[model samples]
Target: MRQGRDNGFQAPLWRAIAVYRIAALTYATILVVRNVAHYQRPVLAWPVVAVMLAWTVFTTYAYANPVRRRPPLLIADLLLTAAALAASVPVVGRQALEEGKPTLAVAWHVAPVLAWAVAGGRRAGITGALLMGATDLIVRAHRDQAALTGSVLMLLAAIAVGYLVRIAEVAQERLQRAIELEAATRERERLARDIHDSVLQVLALVKRRGAGLDGEAGELARLAGEQEAKLRSLVAARSVPADGDDGTDLMTLLSRQESPNVTISGPAEPVRLPPGTAREIAAAVAAALDNVERHCDPGTRVYILVEDAPDEVVVTVRDDGCGIETDRLSQAQAQGRLGVAQSIRGRIEDLGGTVAIVSAPGQGTEVEMTVTRLT
Candidate 1:
């Protein structure tokens, strides 16, 4: 299954910021409309109001897309905010500026501070807040102690919000990583179960049968006994690290399935496969051997050849035993025996591979499994 990004908080956070911007714009508009007649140049102040309204709409739209909230737009936004604060001087008259009366921008000045906070964290937030606050002081000419306190509050708010956003982003990233690790763990456990049921059982059977045989068969049994130990160790050693992709040498996994009676041949170079895919293919091969052990003579020789082609990997398991009659499989299926159908064909088909069995009454049996590797 594909993992999803932890962006659950993103939409709500942006929406809250948008709502705050609109509310601040409304508050600024009310302040301007109420004090228009008191301004030294009402005409100049009216135009500034229009500009503020336009900027509010533009920033609201632009900030919705993360791409537009970067340095270029944020810097422009700060400039506009500073310009608005400066514009209030001539518009509100020298008497109002000296007395430190409320500017037309009012609460709307917080928008740029928020943008910087969201974009670049605490440092950017403090920088933006200080720039806008300094402009407010310059426009006022005489700083009221009340206005200074408000400026300090704005600075604190910017730092707090920026720090919180940074913390939230870090938490979200960790949550995503934990989710991926859990998925990988579950997949590995499932693979372990499947391997235990099919592959380990077949290896144990080979070891047991080979030990009781004589001469060449006994030597084959000794090899099978050694492989059984190696297979167990390999399975125990398999680990699903945090990265999710567990790399395994397909040849090494396949080679462990070898016994004296069943000879395995593959390339000298390691055939690397995704851990899950390699496990399934190996289990499918084991299922094929299980069928041979149950139906054929104990001494019947089997050959397992692995070919790592450019476009696909092919594995052929051939046994020199009495071949299967065409009706035997159907009869077995009808009687509720699905070893070949479910264990062999079903496993291969699930891995997006094909399994072809070439068998006739007097002829030996050969199961060819092919899995495509896309470039």
Candidate 2:
């Protein structure tokens, strides 16, 4: 069985197991001392008890270290505890056991079952519990309600501990994600302040001075003003609450680009992805559109189709514009103009996705991107 990461998140659980071991050991020792006179071999019983004491002390310290809580340690603990429990057949005669004499290990054997559950989760813990429980039953010469009840109780305890550990690990993951979101929010606020103080102020001044100017100067001012407004909106940032629990929806971001010339089509339901992943996909889509806008004539219609499947997402961006010549893309890369390479392919490939661009001299161009869903 594979062990969980050796983090201190489960330190309290380990400590509780250690405390339980010591307490169970003490109780078992008291029982043996009180019934020593009735045992088949009194001298042999003392050595078995001594072995249990030594093992109890060793495991109390060994299990405290996360690194040592692996299969080798857990397996050895279960086997050794089972051996001690089985030793009762010889130390205390079968007749004495049938007369209701307690086993040599008594309640001390359940410690390893809990250790298994904590280290390898429910399945591993249940395995240990069943093995120990069988050993407990075999040690008894007589069968009764009390004997059966002890095994059932140990199995139930193991299941409960396993579930608790799983819940704690999930809670830890959510807390870590929250910390990252808080840090991102703080960074956005700082950048917004800096942009408002400098870049936004300069753009506002440029617009005010060039508002009355004619020809090229007025046109430049208008473009600058448009960029400023877009920048402001970008800095404002989106509220997490508005995007639902799965970050920003890819469909929501792409649908915003729709216009008379740009037609968007996708599933009626939202296509959600992780926040960072959704942003990268949207940016890649934007880059593809920008390519079409730069090379195509005004109002040359474009079609965007989104396909959301169980295992993957497929987005196709096609434009009814002047397609590229065979060597144009390679030439652009050689000239250090990497708009397609960096913005389109780079973004998708970084996310473990793939992009395919098809074009011809007179035919329209098509860019298909596939991003696999992360489980």
lDDT of each: 0.80, 0.86
Q: State model 1's lDDT.
A: 0.80
Query: Which candidate comes out best when scored by lDDT?
Result: 2
- Per-residue error for 18 in candidate 2, Å, reads 0.7
Report residue 171 deviation for candidate 2 (angstroms).
1.1
Model 1 reaches what TM-score against the true structure?
A: 0.59
TM-scores for candidates 1 onward, in order: 0.59, 0.74
Each model's total of backbone clashes: 1, 0
Question: On residues 251-333, what C-alpha lDDT tens digit does candidate 1 reach at each position?
Answer: 77767666657788888777777787888888999999888988987668889999999888999999999889988888998
Which candidate wins on TM-score? 2
Clashing pairs in 1: 220-260
